[model samples]
Target chain A: MSVVRRSRWSYLSLQQAPLLLAFVMLGITVAAYVLFFDLRLHHLPTAFAWDSTISNALPLVFVAAGQGIVVLTRSLDLSVGGIMDLTNSLAATHMHSSVPSMLLWSLIVLAVGGATGLVNGLLVTVGRLQPIVVTIATMSILQGLAAWVLPQPGGNIPASYTNILANSNSPLGLVFIGVVAVFWLLLRRFRLGIALYAVGNDAEAANALGINVRRIRTSAFVLSGIMSAAAGLFLAAGSSGGDATGGDSYLLASFAAVVLGGVSFFGGRGSVIGVVCGAGVVTLLVSVLFYANVNSFYESFYQGIFLIGAVLLGMVVTSLAQRRARGSLRRSRRRW
Target chain B: MRNSLRGPRSSVLAIRLAVSALVGVLMTAGTIATASASSLAAGKDAHFTIALSNSYIGNTWRIEMENEFKSACKMAPIKTAVNCSIYNANNNVPAQRSQMSDLIASGVNAIVTDAASPTGLNSVVQEACARGILVVSFDNTVTAPCALKVNEDQYQMGYLWAKWLAQKLHGHGNVLMVTGVSGTYVNEQRDAGAQAVWKKYPGIHVVDQLNGQWDSEVAQRVVSAALPSLPKIQGIWCQGGTNGVLKAFQQAGRPLPFTAGEAENGFRQLMASGKVQGYSIGQAPYLSVVALGLAYEILSKHLSAAHFKTYNLPLAPVAVQNSNNVKGKTWFPSLGGDFFADVAQTGTGSTVAGLCLASAKSGTACPSGKLVFSFH
Candidate 1:
């Protein structure tokens, strides 16, 4: 047998180094929250501290997950905010209290998301334009459409829809997070999942291996678009209303969450699980700082410090793992 | 054995590190650039915790609003009786929601807020109200029925401005209406009020309407661009950025028109100097102080829930008669153009009376170190 297996630690470390930072950061923030605040676990049922955090963070989580997928394929979707705006406005304005109307509009809103994503993918792949440029242009267009649809921030999202989707009074929000995780897990076993990594790792190499690089890349965007649309629906539910420009802040926030979640911006090397934890870190830090009673002026300053520290820690750990893996390979070869 | 990871992996790592740093820096920089107010520790004698949950802090008006809040906290009655903290959400609804949730969890007795959206914070605000927390919103107020509100009648401000302009034009003139940002509750109400008044005067033709975005420079640029093709403007009805409109007219070599707009110092200065004739009224930044006062009164049992209805503040009287009239109170020569002249009010038994230039400018205590707060 010519094959020599490398050390298991080296293998795990190379693939999962960023997850370590994410989980550790999540743990620290959650612990700090409890320690600083009067977070009685027994009273959590009524306190709504945990429930509201989960509910409020859900939209950003969905947006980050979609951003993570596009990132895994070595591309960026600047139009995530724009797509979210349009779908959010659409859902808020159209959905009434009736189940039939809600259901019908839900499907329509999702289809609109898919259509917008397809346009972005097509423009990037067929037109051979820069992903950034194409997405930026589409983002502006979507924002305009959203503004035209709502014009102002006065649309009604049924109370029932909000309770079912993002209720701060119940643990229903955790189930949605689970759905995203399960979806990603199932996706990892699919052919498209493997191809996304390969394409992101090296597009030319992926092409040589008989993979349709353009199609794979475009599909990644389509999926991202659908996910972003879902994010819009979640946002409408959370706010129970709509604002045309509400999606503007989510653009930078999604990017921040994706990066913090250990998803490589260079593409192809992170899991949605880690991304969830990353989203948790982003959301919970606010509460942690609040309970710690850090002056609001220093809140952002502390957030910056923690973000930089986590990224640096992940990088350091990753390089150390790379060195260990290379060493193990040399040792195994010598033994052979 | 060949390396499975192709390409310059080290170079890739370097670039990845750089990109991550850039994202982090950008996020941090975006937040740090905004003005920030301090938090007051709950003194042992304090009976309640009142937090000011503001939405955005990018512009001067918001900055002044926050400063005025901080100044109010330092005064005699509020300083000893209530513990105050301020939080800015940078206009992100989700972030604001999170802050509100945390404030609720922290068990604050009252939240004085300027909401990010009129309707977005309704559910959370309702939750707060259900939990027996008093929620008072001013400026961009929330739509939740449970919440108490303190604000000037925005529609009335617009009506008064337009009525003044129409009268100046003798009910017949080419009027250019410079509006604030669209899609805002304030802008909508103000515009509607002005249009209502415009309808009554058939000869007051609103030749064009441009969005000033409520900023001085933006108003100047848009008005300047439209000046070339516009007919002689006999009157100007502006929601904000009034000084910018005058500068645009000045730069165009056109005679300054009779104008009615927000109470920026520069606009009042021009009026005092006899350079232009105009009427000004403002959504006073001190509304925050009033909201805080209302919240404090409710918490301290000085005012009952019966007094919990929307408190509509009267607009400040824009004193632009001469330099001496507005020198220290209405228009400060030492202050910049973007400064709101109506930061403090006196002689009105409102919460913001007795506030001084130092109080609005630097969050300092007045010489008297006393605050007069009336429920009415």
Candidate 2:
């Protein structure tokens, strides 16, 4: 057999290192659960034979990954939970009240998400406020108002539409992965994404390098808001019903998932691929805890510890990564 | 002998004391004779107008209770009633206080209110009593000199629930006890009752006692966070029906842990799940009817005030594993508006047979709303 020369496509495939790592980790965890815990992958709804753990993870992973993108740009949006709450309510309220209306509501939810992000961006870029401080306040205020939108927990989501979404064979999952691909491509293509990197790295220096630091930073929050709305729509469909307090927990989880995925909390460093894997890790850990017959009550605390721990680790890694990148840049210049 | 032995001043003091004592004895006998004669008369027209106050439409239980109260008292046979001005305190104590003051100002004959705070309302209760307006309380009880209370036997409810749970768990398990509002009287009585049942079963252990504060979101967070800390847990002891456990379990993609509380949709759904081993406790929302009916009985001179069991007029806390399995004994028969009529007309449930509304397949027939009407 003659050895053939490798093509450029081979190199491109190797570039998806973070995603491959996540998949390998997911497989190992799933295998471990099946082997050690004797858990049957049978919590799946009748229409699909897949396990409910996996089904539930679909929306979770999507939302966390969406949240990861914003964290990369050095801003946070606590209002995503609000977006989820509103989306869930709007979906239930508008469903087969008019089908077209439901689809319109979906877009409107995204618009609301983006609008929330826009507000955050304006605050950060124009008002110049710290992201966490701003987002945290917004989170509290929005939750108080959720009851005004819908006081009771019950609402009709046109069972047929809800059924289709809930029972579908992870079509949303596939679509989510596609959106991630397009987003990744667009970010890599645009001046905004590149300028975001430069600004996140060093705002003053990026401005010196002719990057529109303020505009790019503002755009980051706007994108985060839009993505959150999309995530909310998916989340609303998954939960079956809507309530004022529905999105309360997501506020913290989104931040945790971003930190865990390798996004730097202090601005520049980390990867989107890493954040996706981080979301997977969380999903895996919780699933394992459930399968291990852990007390059902301790899940929340465990999640909290896991999140706070991940954030601390992200901080350490970010410091190290920044140093390594700087060293590499210096060495490259010496060679030149 | 008195002239030789006693001073004139001493004689005068003794005479004054003797006359005062004589008047007091006669007044006391007259009051007793009046109550005795009324009970002897069998029936007199006893009527009262009630001013009702609601806290807020916060939970399903409260909403249903309000509906029950409305139906029970609206049709009460009291000869005269002004409209029961329903005021929502929005769960604020001050707001409730202001509403009570307003009701008092409106010159109502009786004001029946559920206080937001457990103790601060005693002043308002006293004020009503001082005005010769009768004071009847439900849900929230305040201590007053001659106050009559209409509520559930909370201690018994907690005891019964714990006893049943203990039996179901086979006398032993790692059961987490989640409580209702941290400091509410219901929580206190229910907890006392639960502890009483637990005393009998030395094998069962209460691993953790937490406050859910009657909130679903908070419950979910508290329960979710606490689940990992427990070891070898068999079931949960839910002192609330806030939908937190149900939602948390669903999110975890597992069957619900055991629970008990109000018979709300979440708890009801959880019970229907074959894996859930729990029972529910229902509060009689139509309790005002019971109080008012009792009040009518007391004022109309049908029920002997001496026969009243102190101020306790607690109705039964209905227990049900499932709506289909909810048996007759758990239903409150005194709820029928007719029961008030029967007690007014004949004095016993057996005598009120012709007056009761159609008893739904369940035996304890209730009036459209209330059974025992309170006077105040």
Candidate 3:
């Protein structure tokens, strides 16, 4: 009886593993931010505002959230950078002074983003192409398109649009984050989401169980495309201009966030919330380095070390849990 | 399992196929663009055909440089005597090399380039020279012996700013040194120049050196982050984004320091408003025009390429005291914030009257000016 009880508790903990990891990452990010701020300022910054932090982390969060979904389905989207660049270029070039035009341009950008995603999905699933290859091709095409649209970085984006998207006090960024999180939660309740998890965990088993593995994989890419487009919009809004190469930096960061969020690279695990927190950690890490007054030359080095450490920590926690669960199963079997 | 081996193999094959296809498409596109551009120059018998091969247009500075070239090409003498075409490589050194080769094949008389690297384009530049095409390299230049170089002393731009900052601070103060992108040649040279000056002034302490990436928004964030840790900075030696550095100080409610940086319009505006005391020593965007003029001179056989090898153009450091007076002349008050305030032709024998904001932006026709170089 005791063995069964202990096994049940272990199973429950295992089920909550992703959530626990996410909280731990969030805690670390906040602690690091405070510690760095104190170390730099020689005192705790009074009345720390979440507004700037939210705005800063929002772009990466959007990308990582989509990336987490794709990773969950055992695929990768290298085209996020291209999608972001395209959206940024388009918005900067077309989203001019008028509020109505801004809205139209925004929709157009998002649609383009979704279309790019659709192409990636189709190539990977229908065309029987590799995800990496498809996304990379699409990324190149999108980057070229972006360069063609805006050869240079100078474009007049409407201040009103920038004000709405980038404003710290506006709550638009937070609301957007909330909406994406809620959407993921809603998705989890759907058949497609469960199918995605099943497909990622074991495609052969999922196929045997009558799930369309191809559709799940395609849907994940499509979702990733849409999310990347959203990230591009926020990035353009925040920067208040178009930069063809701005999105390139987010590519590695998105993958790193997914891993740090405790999302298994092999897929079928991790939550959207965890991914969002993981992005928060990555973004906060940059802020910490800046605040710490670390030499600019060593910034990349420090970031690399922190990222590797986070991934290692996640791996160790996962293996320990697996080992404990396996031991418990053995003990329970013996008792039986 | 059979599935595992096939999966990796097929993926590798797909990647290879996709990359080759993309390369093929890009090559075709490049050929077509080059063909059309060169054809425009083919029709003019009397005009000296010149092409500007710019390696990057990722920043406002490059845009300004290109615009200056366009405006200069439209000017009276060049308008009738030369057919100029601009080709940008989007920061790819290989693409630039290929572009230069195409230009050489197109039979252009001269090729002016703002090279992506000092040594990356040496072979192509040598190839162009061997094909009897005059190549003028500027800004980020090539090290090819055959090419004529037109550049301001970048080292002096940093040295003068540091010297001015040191003088303003009375040789003793805490200073925050905001630099440009890390690992870049320009950044390294600027840092070296500043360090050379700052080392002499042992009293002036450099509290921090942050990389601003030569961008306004980035500089603002970096300076803001470093501000709290800093102890009452009396001077700021910034390589670029002076406006952003000032904005950060304003945001923090700190008194503006004796700042020195590039000739960004916003920085000049701040100087005019007496919000910041500083100097705007610009790496002039009109250096492109100087380079184009050199190409024109060489192509026309007015200047011998052998005699006029490395031409170091003079540097003009604009002080804050002159900011208000030089608004319409040296700087544009009505232009966008990112506009490089110092857009004048720095070389001798070139009149400043023709190089205005309107001509630079819209490529309006201007009176002809002679291409004269003051050699190093």
Candidate 4:
């Protein structure tokens, strides 16, 4: 009887590699964090509670999640932060007097975000430009437009809206959960999701298999844009209005979070769950550093160092696991 | 790829998806029930919103300005309290002008500004005033005539520096003057005041003048740079705060060079640290809050000139120092130990007696052995 088996190359090329690696990296990061900060089990609560420093990180989590999706599709959304900046102002300006009125304003702002993302999609796929340059241009344009919209970091997001989004955990968290679940289901079963994966894995092969590469990539960007906008609106819930400078710092953090999540810079292999875990670790690390009274300047440098160490640990762990499995296989085959 | 494009081509399916998404957004917004009406006094005839535009919260002085301004807002009449909000331009003048327009659109009744550049902001000043929005500028004066100008007399800042330095050195020394941004309002007056007073004291020579640009770090570098160039630099007359100067000198291993500075907490801290010669002129930006109070009074015509004068609100003066003469003058917190004692009265006797050349009037400045509370 002929035994059908996967090749070693196939195992190395599998998308699961990035996911497994991300999980291991996250574990190592959490462990190292516990050691560096001297954070004992007694310090942690049964459930994560939102506080001032943690709240500052919500937008970072949101944007990083969106960027994670984009990264999984072998692309990056450079305009996420800029799109955030634009939408924040749009929400602030249009959302006039009263909670209901402000929410309607946010919806309008979200639509604007969708539209902006669509523009980026058309530029990259239809125009056939590099994602980096395309987004760099849109980033500036969106930020400029934001400054034009709000001018100064003034205006109110209305207590009714911010009170719920920033302070209260009403249905927003549930909706966030819903978004993740829906995304997971789509990735697992939906045609569009499969096409997206196929394109990211190998665009030419996907094309030969009859996938419209451009369409998949464009749709990926659109999803990314929407997520970024949602994150912006969420952040506006915290500031309760618009700040033109508010979203800028998040751009770098999102990119860093994606990379730290064990997502390859080359892309095509990552999961939302991995990215979310990465965000949790980064957020926890930052807040712990703050509570530890670390100097403000060293924060970014420490995070970078942590990333380097996490990546190295991931590589070592994966290699060791591979060697162990190989030894086990040889032993079993020899016995046979 | 062509085959994939044909898979989802039903127009009806696309329409259903689009409609469903719209519904999703609508339902989500409805659930959130977010409020907007961005005004504190919505649909109220008596109350009004006022926008306060600052160039930047660039220093500790600006921070204190904010602290005091917020405190003063609480002191306002509850019913007609000014709905004041601040727009920090982050040191961008053009950005500030654009902010001014946003404020106008937001329906703020009055604006109190610290002009980023006195000349360039005229157009916005003109536009704001034309819209019947009262404009008052403080800290930095507007070249275009605004209704009220409330700022520390810049000349007084320099004159006091020179006087204090000359006295500290027994009326004879090579003095170093560290001024702020060269072409602006404050620097010009401060330089002129220093030069004018130092001309009378032939022995008090003006050896070197450097623009410290009102930044503590810059002040430090300039003072350090100029120290070696001076011939036995008997005194240092800093037109602005000298916390930076003291820090730089200390860090550079340079001993005390008889310094005078803007009366500020920085100077007080420097004095307390025993690093500075201990004299500064504090410009309370909270004066503008008072100016805002005055502007509202003027606009509502609630008080006449006499009644306004009777309000007894003026620039609250406090000399930054460690002398017994400057103790208990202002709200001296723990760190300000003996710093503000008689600080308000620093320029009182000198202003009347002409003893302190920094005072604008002869018999009204601080007496001998007392420092004058002058603005920079």
Per-model TM-score, in order, reads 0.91, 0.45, 0.50, 0.49
Worst 10 residues of 3 chain A by lDDT: A290-299
In the predicted model 1, the residue pairs found to clash are none
Deviation from native of the Cα of residue B53 in model 2, angstroms: 36
lDDT of 4 by residue, A179-270 (tens): 65477666758887777667778889999998988888888888788878888877676656566655766787788777677666665666
TM-score of 1: 0.91
List each model's interface RMSD: 6.6, 31.1, 21.7, 19.3
lDDT of 1 by residue, B274-374 (tens): 89888878778888999998888788788986666799876544423343346677788878888998878744455556677777788777877778788
Which lDDT tens digits does candidate 1 get at residues A36-119?
565323233234888999998898888888888889999999999999899989998999999999999989988998888899
- Estimate, for each residue in B131-186, the C-alpha lDDT of model 2 and write its tens digit: 67766677766444445677768787777777777887888887778788643567
Task: Return the lDDT, model 2, position B271.
Answer: 50
lDDT of 3 by residue, A85-127 (tens): 8888788888878878988998898888888888888899899
Q: Which sequence of candidate numbers ranks them by TM-score, best first?
A: 1, 3, 4, 2
Q: For candidate 4, what is the DockQ-based docking class?
A: incorrect
Candidate 3: lDDT of A63? Answer: 88
Q: Using DockQ as the measure, which candidate wins? A: 1
lDDT at position B362, candidate 4 = 18
The CA lDDT at B19 in model 4 is 47
At residue B35, what lDDT does model 3 achieve? 43
**Which of 2 and 4 is ahead in DockQ?**
4
